[model samples]
Target: MPAEDILRIEGVSMQFTGGAGLFGRRNRTTVRAVDEVNLSVRKGETLGLVGESGCGKTTLGRCILRAHKPSHGRILYRRDDGTEVDLAALSRAQLRPLRTEIRTVFQDPNSSLNPRMTVQQIVGEPLVVNGLARGSEVADRVADTLRRCGLRPELMRRYPHAFSGGERQRIGIARALVTQPRLVVADEAVSALDVSVRSQILNLLEDLQEELDLTYVFISHDLSVIQHLCDRVAVMYLGRIVEEAETEDLFEQPRHPYTEALLRSVPRPDPRLRRRDDVLPAGEVPAPDEAFAGCRFQPRCRYAEDICAREEPATLPRCHFAEDLTLDGVYATDVRQTS
Candidate 1:
């Protein structure tokens, strides 16, 4: 682990068992939602987790937050005082204090915020629950947080129903920030908003990060958004990370076939440069319950060969012909022109 890293996810995995037959016999099926994922988040850096739906990005985020207990592995988190603690081993009571240091901004603002609770209650709940503030002090802190999120303090008394989509998202941000968390996991934070509103939220997040010295785990399927917001990115596919690199490098010179396909799928603004044929893999993602002896992506990967189907690839960089193949990335001209 790097000395500067605030969070370290070491070989983490999550499995869920379900499906019962009519006779009440346990089907005994297990789905590995997160599969031995190793990642690190440096202090004050936004690490974007990007992938297609059902790729376990959300599951990994939940595991980091201890919202879902991992089936195996450790999550080490560093405190403000420079003490490292194993979050995976902490009890619920022990985790209570740590909750203030790690918060989450959910995807659907409408569904996340309580319509019955006023913004003041929504944002101040964390402070009150944690016994960090009481009475008028909570209100004062809520007002300050609202203002920081570009919302009027007077709107603090209003219910979620009174706010627009953007306003509701701001309220969510205010709520997440009320605890003054060191690390935040924003799970599709802007995916549900309008394009304009998404930009506004993204900018607001960036400003808040600078002002508060916050570290973020930004999880989203939107590659464009990831490119815009993240310093580094990890691309997940079927519960495993296929590629991770600096944002510019990952977009400009993707090493993994999956990464290349994802980059190619991005719409080019220039009609002349637009891709005519689909560059994506042909088949659907494999089911989590299905066991695969070889590379899970082999069935869909156009670059896959007999070896790819015969042996399971190690979870390391360039596991299969990474140096030999020159995978395509978004053209530098297209990126420059767009920027």
Candidate 2:
């Protein structure tokens, strides 16, 4: 049987309204960080959300974890018991119990970790807050989780200040996994680590997923990293998903112009295979609040036509010319910098 959809995000959009203009005298600014996005994440698969910075990758991930209540749409999450819940519609109290089954690994290791807390305290914090464990049990669970992430159990007493960047990230992973979450939303989880350490963390994540049968929503702007770890790819642009396909399929034959431009931006270490024919997307990313009558990527899309600016393409491979355009992708070249 095919894997079931663990999470279904339907027409989810998150908007933020901020302070009045420059001198605190103008109209309030409205920023739609996450526009209408629909995605289905299968069980045990890593669904990668990729795009340029400020393209709403993190915002979408936050919406998934319910860290940000979407301004519109349903976030249908299926629990282990097979009961489905609309996370977007739930109150904080109702969502509290569900949080144990859904977790997040944040971007910055240093900032994400509590400076004053010990490794044990940090990793065990969730277990304690959720009433999953207490006293000596929390300690034991913390130690095991640390060991699972490649850290020594003895280091549990030490502070986050003592570990290297990679080790600190390991602790972050442990904390997220401590709840034994079925769905993990990792927002730029490995971006802060050194190249050498990135693969190690990536490898650890893969191992943990296999052992726990975990499903991940991996959010990152780094296509190289996305290709390395994800089973499927969703390309976002200007707060909307433009394309989504199996990892290799999207990398080998991107149908959307935005996806193609993103693939073109990936550096090829071997000069012989570098893609010379493709041009990266030009023009600044439009302001978040800017209205788009048709395609959001029309301004930067090379394949865009007159109709593209007048008619909004439906959500599939969101491009007016997608069927006709044989857009380039990361061909034979290896995009990963780390071995």
Model number with the top TM-score? 1
Question: Candidates' TM-scores?
Answer: 0.96, 0.95
Give one digit per residue, the lDDT tens place, for model 2 in 1-339.
Answer: 124899999999999999887798888878999888988999999999999899998989988888899999999999998889999999999999999999999899999999999999999999999999999999999989999999999989999999999999999999999989999999999999899999999999999999999999999988899999999999998898889999999999998988888888888767556564545777889988899898998888777789989988985798877888777778745343443
Residue 142 in candidate 1 has what lDDT?
Answer: 96
User: In each prediction, how many residue pairs overlap at the backbone (N, C-alpha, C within less than 3 A)?
Assistant: 0, 0
lDDT of 1 by residue, 220-318 (tens): 988889999999999988888888899999888998888888888887777657552445888788888988777777788888899988886685553
User: lDDT, candidate 1, residue 180?
Assistant: 96
Over 4 Å off in model 2, which ranges? 1-3, 21-24, 273-278, 332-339
- Model-by-model lDDT, in order? 0.90, 0.90
Name the lDDT of candidate 2. Answer: 0.90
